[model samples]
Every structure is written in C-alpha cells, then in structure tokens.
Target: MEEQAKQKLKNYVLWLLSRQEYSRRDLTFKLQKKEASPEYIESLLDWCESLNYIDETRYCEGFIRRHLAKNHGYARIKSEAGAKGIDKTLLAFQIEEMEIDWFQLARTAYIKKFSNITDTPDYKQKAKIVRYLMYRGFNYEQIEFAYTHNQS
Candidate 1:
C-alpha cells in the first residue's frame, strides 16, 4: 500500500514539474497538501534531486530571468524568491553570480511607468515616484539612483 502511494506521488510530482520548476520547500508543501506521507515526500525529493529533476540553482536562474524581463527590482525579486521557499544564501549567491544591475532595472521600470521627465520634479511628485519604486521592491540606494539619474 505504501509503495503504491509512493508511486502515485512520484507520478504526481513529475507531472507538476512538467508544468514548472518548484523549490524543494514548494514541492514538500504541495505533496503534504495532497496527503502524501512526510517520509515518502522526503525520499521522493531525494530521488528527484539525484535524478537532477529538482535543482535549486536551476530554479533560481529561471525565476530571475522571468522576473528581470518583467523589470522587477532586486528587492522584489529576492522577496518573491523567498516566498517561493528558496534559501536566502542560495538566492544571494545566484544574485551575485548573475551580476544583475538592480539600479538600472529600477530606472527602466520608472521610465516605463512615467515616460521621460523634462524638468526637475516637485517634492510631491518625487515622493510619489519614490513610493511607487519602493513598492516595486527596490532598496533605498537603487531608488535614489533611479530618481537622481532619471530626474531632470
């Protein structure tokens, strides 16, 4: 019975992976929700890893690519990755390795939203832009750089 259940879970996991890459934690939670035994889930995850079917680094790379294409800031990207159950250390390593220019991305995002600014913005306008950038997951330094360079 346990073997049958494990086979079912393995098939389900493969099907899920076919749709998208998932972090180990994401897979664990998903399997748990499906009533899979914790022991089976752990062993299954190990098997998946051994087979190279589940890899954190690969997942992170793909995730970063997709989000960066959407013009998300580093902060927002990191936050979203964390929410998806990626380890902070691994995420930091990937970010550093990728050499992502967060400030540049932030500037691009601001430009897309506001178009080109011909004159220096008023205090109120600057504040609104700052708030929007922050909400978009940029750190203070990245936001400042975007505002300074983009503002006329």
Candidate 2:
C-alpha cells in the first residue's frame, strides 16, 4: 500500500508536468494540498529533480519568454515570476543574458494601448498614460521614452 501510494503520487506529478511547467516550490505546494506526506513529497521532488523533470532554470526561462511575448517589462515579469516561486537572482541573470530591449517593448506596449491618439497628449492625458504604462510594468525612463518618441 505504501508503494502503491508513492506510485500514485508519481503518476499524478508526471501528468501535471505533461500539461505545463511547475517550479519545485509550486510542485511541493500542490502535492501538499493533495494531502501527501511531507517526507514522501520531498523524496519524490528529489527524484523529479534528478530526472530533470522539475528544473527551476528551465521553468524560469519559459516563464520569462511567455511574459516577454506579452510585452511585459522587467519589474512586472520579476514580480509575477517571484509569485510563481522562481528565484529572483536566477530570473535577473536570465533577463540579463537575454539582452531584452525594454525600451522597445515599452514603446510597443504604449502604441498598442494608445494607438489612436496621434497628437501630443495634454498634462492630464500624459498622467493617465504614465499610470497605465506603470501598471503594465515599465519604469519611468522607459515610459518617458515611449510617450515622447511615439508622439513625434
């Protein structure tokens, strides 16, 4: 029965992995929620790690790629990835290695949201645009560049 329970947990983990990537922390939380023993879950996680089934680096890379495609900035991606149990240092390193064009992405996000407005915005409108960009994860410098460059 003990062996059967472990096999069941392993099979469930494999099925979940087949559907999507999960960080080790996320997987642990998930298995815990299923009422599995902590020691058993830890051992299973170790096995998964040994088999390369739950790699933090791989999960972080994929997460970054998906968020980048959505035009998210570094701050937003880092925040979201952290919530998803990714390590901040690893995420920062990956972002640096990728050499992402944050300015360009910010500009793209700006255009996508405010494409209809061709003329320079007034003070109130500029404030609104800045707020919107900020919420979308762009920094002040990037937001400034996006609006100023796009207006001209």
Scored by CA lDDT, what does every candidate get? 0.86, 0.90
| TM-score to true structure, per model | 0.88, 0.94
Give candidate 1 regions above 4 Å deviation.
Answer: none
Predicted structure with the largest TM-score when compared to the true one: 2
lDDT for 68 (candidate 1) = 88
Q: Per-residue lDDT tens digits of candidate 2, residues 14-77? A: 9999999998898899899888999999989999999999889889999999998888998899
Per residue, candidate 1 scores C-alpha lDDT tens digits across 2-102 of 77777888999999999999889989999999998788889899999999999989999888889888888888888898788778898889889999899
**Candidate 2 regions off by >4 Å?**
none
Per-residue error for 60 in candidate 2, Å, reads: 0.6
Clash count, one per candidate: 0, 0
Give residue 63's lDDT in candidate 1 (0 to 100).
88
**With candidate 1 superimposed using the best TM-score fit, by how many Å does residue 86's alpha carbon deviate from the native?**
1.4
Candidate 1 matches the true fold with a TM-score of 0.88
Clashing pairs in 2: none
Q: For model 1, what is the C-alpha lDDT against the true structure?
A: 0.86
